[model samples]
Target: MREISLDRLRTLVVIADLGSFAEAARQLNLAPPTISLHVAELEARIGAPLLTRARSQVRPTAIGETLLLRARRLLADADLALDEVRRQVEGLTGRVRLGASTGAIAHLLPQALEHLRAVHPGIDVQVQVLTSQASLAGLREGTLDIGLVALPQVAGKGLEVTPWRRDPILAYVPADWQPPARVTPAWLAQRALILNDSSTQLSRVTNDWFAAAGLYPQARIELNYNDAIKSLVGAGYGATLLPQEGEAAELDRRIVRRPLRPGLWRQLGIACRQEQVERATGYVLQALARLRQ
Candidate 1:
C-alpha cells in the first residue's frame, strides 16, 4: 500500500476545522482545486468517503473523524521531532564524550560540570576514567570528544593539546608523624610509601623525581587511584606524592599534605580532535577553561 502523505493529512485537518473548502484553501494559501484534490486523494487511499455535504456546512464522515484525530497527533509529533533536531544542530542540546584521570574527575570535573549545568543544561557530558595514554588513544580512534591529560604531549595531526593547568606535587603522610616543613625524595624514600602503579603517568613523574636525587624509592604497595592512595596515607599505611588539585575547603585531618622541596609540578593539557569539535564540545571546553590557573 502507498504511504499516506502528511500534506494531504494536514489538508484534511484544516478542511474539517473551517467546514468550507474555499476557507481551507484561503487559510492554507492553496488553490481551491488543490484543497479538494488533497481530500480526494486521502479518501481514495483510505478507500472511504471522508467528507460529506450536510445541508450547508461541510462535515467529516465517521471514518474521516477517526483519521483526523490520528492526523492531528501525527503532525504534532512530527513537528516536535523536527524542533529537537534543530536544537541539536544549533548546539543548543547534545551529548559529548569526555575522558580524564580519576584525580581530575574527583577534584576538577565537578566545577566544570556545575558551570555547564548553569549555562548549557541541555548538553550532556559522558565521562570516562582513563589513563593519559588511553585518553589520547581514544581521541585518535574517535571514541572520545575531549581529554584531560597529563602534559608533555605532542599534539598529533588534527589533535589540539593545550596546556590547561599546573599543580605542585605534594607529600601526603599520616598527620601524627611530625615531619619536616618540606618533603624531599630522601626523607620520603625512608618512609613506608604508597605509589601509583608504574602504568600511570604520575608514577613515571614521581619515579623521575626520586631518581634525580640519586634515590630510587620502592613502594610498599602500588595503586592507581589518588583517593585510594590518600585513604591509605590517612591510615598511616604509607606516604605518597600527588598533585595538589586546588585549595581544598576541608583538609583530611588524619593525613597532612606538604609541598615537595624541589617544587615538582604536574602539567595537564586539554586535548581534543580539532576537526571533531562540535558546538556542545566548545561549550564544555569553555567551562573547563574557567578552572585554568
Candidate 2:
C-alpha cells in the first residue's frame, strides 16, 4: 500500500469544510477530477470509504470523521513547518498580516512598522486597519497573523495579548478654546463636543467616562475616524478625546491635550492566537517588548 499523501489530506480537509468537491477544487486551484482522484486514492490507502454522496451533499463516514480531526492537525503542522523552513532560509522573509485598531493604525503602528522594516528588510508586513471588533475577529479567523488592539480583548476571549504600551487618555481641545486648568465632568459638559464614532473602543470608553461624570456630551458632530475628528476640532468644531501618544504631533499647534483630572489610561497591545506564535510574531513580540523600555 502506498503511503497517504499530505496533498490528499489537505484536499480532504477542504472538501469537508466546503462540503462540495467542486468548491474545494476551486479553492485548491485543482480540477474536479483531480480532487476526486486524490480522495479516492486516500480512501484506498486507508482501506475505508471516507465519504458518501447523496443528492449532491457529501457526508463524511465515521472513519472519515476520525481522520478529519487528524488531517486538520497534520495540515496545520505542515504549514507551520514550511513557515519555519522558509524563515530559516530567507531570514524573516514572507508575508505577515497584521490588524490594528483605528487608534493604533493612525499613530502607534507606523513607528513600529518603520522600526521593524529598518531591521528586517526581507519581511513583508501587511496591515489592515480595522475596528477593535473586526481586528479581534481577523486574528481569530487566521486572516491576521498578529494584531494591535486596545487591551482587555473586548471582542475575542482566547487571544494571547501582550502589553505593548500604556497611553494616557487625554482630552483634546482646539488651541485657544479651554479656560479650565483641568477637566471635570461639569467642565467637560460645558464644552462643545466632537465625538469619535462608536466603532472604536476608545469612543466607548469615553462615553462611559461621560456616564460616570454625570455629564452627557452635547455632541455637535460625530466622526468615525480620528483624522476626521481632528480636522473638525482644528476647525473649531468641538473637543475630542484621544490617547496622548496618538495626539503628540497634534499637540504641537492645532490641538492641545490635557490629562483628564482623574487620570485614565488605556493599554494597547499586540494579540495573536496563543498557538500561532512564530518567527514573524517573535519579531513583533520583540518590538512590543521594546515599547516597554
Candidate 3:
C-alpha cells in the first residue's frame, strides 16, 4: 500500500486555503508546477482525482473533500504530538480534555480545575459539560480525553471507574414549610415538586427511585437547568430534588434541604477508556487526586 506523504497533504491544504494552486505555490515558496505535480502524484497513488478544475477556480472532488478533512486533523494531531513529546521530556506541559456531568461540574469540578491550573499552569485543560449519558458517549468515541460521571453508570464495558465522592440527595421544600418529622418517599410525595428535565439520566434515576418506592410526587414543573429550578423553588413555586452534597446555596436560601431517609445517594467518579490510561487520562486522575486532598 502507498503511504500518504506530508507534502501531498500540505499541497491539498494549501490549495484549499488559498483557493488557487499558483497562490499556494507562491505562499509555499515552491514553483506552481512542482505543487501541481505533488498533488497529481498523490492522486495517482490514491487512484482518484482529488480536484475538479474549472475555468477560473478549483474545487475538491468528493473523495478529495473527505481527505481534506482527515488531512487537517492529521496535521493538527501531528503538531500536537510533537509539542506534547517535547513537553513530556521537559516535564512542562500536558493537554487534557474532560467531559463533566452537570452535577459534577456544579459541585466538584471548579475547585479541581482551579487547583490544577494553580499547580500545573503548563498543562492545558479543556472541559465539556454534558449529561452523564453524553459524557459516556464522548468517552467511548475518544473525543473526550477523560470524564467524571456518577457511578454505576461508569461501570460499563471498555472503561474503568475510580470512586471519587459520594453525594447525598437533598429534598427542596417550600420556604414556608418546616423540616418533615421524617424523610420518606411518601413524605416527599406530599409536596408539589419541580423535577429535572425528563431527558436527563439524573431525572430517570430519580423517577426510578420513586417508582421503586411506590410513590409519586405531584410534579408542578419539569425543567433541566439547575439555576432555573432553584429560581422556581425560591419563588415558592414548588420543591425540587437536588443533589445533597453539591453547591446548592441558591436553592438552600429559598428552600429547606433535608437528606432523604435510608440514605439515597449518588456516587461521583472519574471514568476513562482503558487505552487512554497513559495519555490525557492521567492528567485528569492527577487533578482529581489533588482536589480530593
Candidate 4:
C-alpha cells in the first residue's frame, strides 16, 4: 500500500465538514475531479469505501471515521512541525502564545511588545484577549505559552503565577461635573456610577472599597469593555472606576481622570508552566519583565 497523502486526508476532512463534494472543492479551491480522485485514492489505499453519499449529504463510513480521527491529530502535528522549521529558515527563533484581558492588551502589553520588537526581533509573540480564568485554563491545558492575568490567582499544578505589576485604579468622571481633586468611595458612590461588571476583579475590588466605607451603591450600568465604559463617562452617562495602567491614561475633553482616595490598585500576574522555559518563550518573558513596575 502507498503512503497516505496529507492533501488527500485534508480533502476528506473538508468534505465531511462541508458535506458536499462540490462545496468541499470550492472551499479547498480544488477541482471537483481532484476531490473525487482524492477520496478514491484514499479508499483504494485502505481497500474500503471511505464515504457514502445519500440525499445531497456525504457521510463517512466506519473505517473513514477511524481514519478521520487519526488524520486530525496527524494534521495538527504536521502543521506545528512545519511552523517550527519555517521559523528557523525565516530568521525567527521562537513563537510564543500569550493571553491577557482587553484592558491589559490595550495598555500593559504594548510596552512588552515594543521591547520584544526592538531587542528580540526573532521572537514572535501571538497575543489573544482573554479573561483571567480563560488565560489560566489555557496555560493549564498546554495551549498557551504565557498568560498575563489578574492577580490573586490560585497557584495550580505545573504552573507558576507571580505578581507582575500593580496599577492604581482611578475614578473616571465627566469633566463638566466639577468633581473634587481626589475621589473617595463615599463621595463617588452617592452619584450615578458606571462600573466594571461583577465578573471582573476590578469590580470586586471597587465593590470592596465601597463596602469598607459602609456604602453599597449600585451602578447605573456595568460593562466589561474598559474603553467603551470610558466613552460613556465622556458622554456624562456616569462615572466608572478603572485601572490607570502604565503611564498616563488620558481620555478625551469630556472625561477627567481622578485618583482614588485611600488607594486601590489592580494587581496583575504573569503565569507560565513549571518546566524550564524555551529560548523563545524566555525572550518573551524577559520582554514582559521590562514592563514591571
Worst 10 residues of 3 by lDDT: 244-253
Tell me the spans in candidate 3 whose CA falls farther than 4 Å from its real position.
1-84, 88-91, 154-157, 246-252, 276-280, 291-293
Tell me the lDDT of candidate 3.
Answer: 0.76
Let me know the TM-score candidate 4 reaches against the reference structure: 0.70
lDDT of 2 by residue, 50-82 (tens): 998989988899999999999999989999999
Lowest lDDT block of 10, candidate 2: 243-252
Candidate 2, residue 146: Cα displacement in angstroms equals: 0.9
lDDT of 4 by residue, 1-293 (tens): 47999999999999988889999999999999999999999998999998999998999999999999999999999999999888755546778899998888988888888988987788878889888888889999989999998888885899999889998888899999988999998889888998888877788889999999999999999888889999999999999999988775476889998898888999999999999887788878888898887
| Per-prediction TM-score to the true structure, in the order listed | 0.88, 0.66, 0.65, 0.70
Higher-ranked by TM-score: 1 or 2: 1
Cα-based lDDT for every prediction: 0.91, 0.78, 0.76, 0.89
lDDT of 1: 0.91
User: After best superposition, candidate 3 residue 25: deviation in angstroms?
Assistant: 31
Q: Which candidate leads the pack in TM-score?
A: 1
Flag the better candidate by lDDT, 1 or 3: 1
Give candidate 4's whole-model lDDT. 0.89
Candidate 2 all-Cα RMSD: 13.7
Question: RMSD (Cα, Å) of candidate 1?
Answer: 2.5
